[model samples]
Target: MNTQLVESVIQLIRSLSPEEQAILQEKLFFDFAYPSTPDLITLALRGGSFEFLNDEPDLYSLTDGEPIPCP
Candidate 1:
């Protein structure tokens, strides 16, 4: 670990107000709990399951509010 970088980050975090710290803590927790979409897709592809989504009938794109048009 880079001790200097760690110390700098710690100092920056400590400079935040209590409310800001709480918000940052919640965001970090959420990030740890849920992987990003691209990360999830990568994991699914590695598991040989990503293609199944294409076969599903009721799937929709998360980026756009539009439904996925079936072929």
Candidate 2:
């Protein structure tokens, strides 16, 4: 991801409450498969999980079905 976009997402995530943050973390770790779209982003924010959203066609798949590696 681009630095700016990643920064923006980090800012948005920071704005969420701890419980919501936990939900997002759990999804990121276990449920979400990324390369998500704007709609999927919205769904994740609304549902607290990415399970309802479909895989994004353009974004790259998460290799080895693993959680995103930490920087």
Candidate 3:
């Protein structure tokens, strides 16, 4: 293990401006922050998790209900 090299790298990171540090941090941890998981809605659809919706009837329409009477 190169302890001196690690310490030098830490010092270099510390010298970066806040914005630069933020960019560096994101670059370092981007994989962990935004993993390659399927989108939630897509996963649900493709996995048949919402297959029950196929059995549900269309119970309401825009014109199905009576309009309210204005006083």
Instruction: Please give each candidate's TM-score.
Output: 0.44, 0.40, 0.50
Candidate lDDT scores, in order, read 0.87, 0.79, 0.87
lDDT tens per residue, model 2, 1-71: 59999999999999999999999998888666565588677886788576545564545555646686889
User: Candidate 1, which segments miss by more than 4 Å at Cα?
Assistant: 32-71
Ranking by lDDT: 3, 1, 2
Worst 10 residues of 1 by lDDT: 59-68
Residue 23 C-alpha lDDT in model 3: 95
Query: Residues 13-33, candidate 1, lDDT per residue (tens digit)?
Result: 999999999999999887789
Top candidate when judged by TM-score against the true structure: 3
| Model 1 quality (TM-score) | 0.44
Residue by residue across 31-68, what tens digits does model 3's lDDT show?
Answer: 56763566666778788978999999999889888987
Q: Candidate 2 — which residues are off by over 4 angstroms?
A: 32-71
Candidate 3 segments whose C-alpha is farther than 4 A from its true place: 1-6, 27-38, 62-71
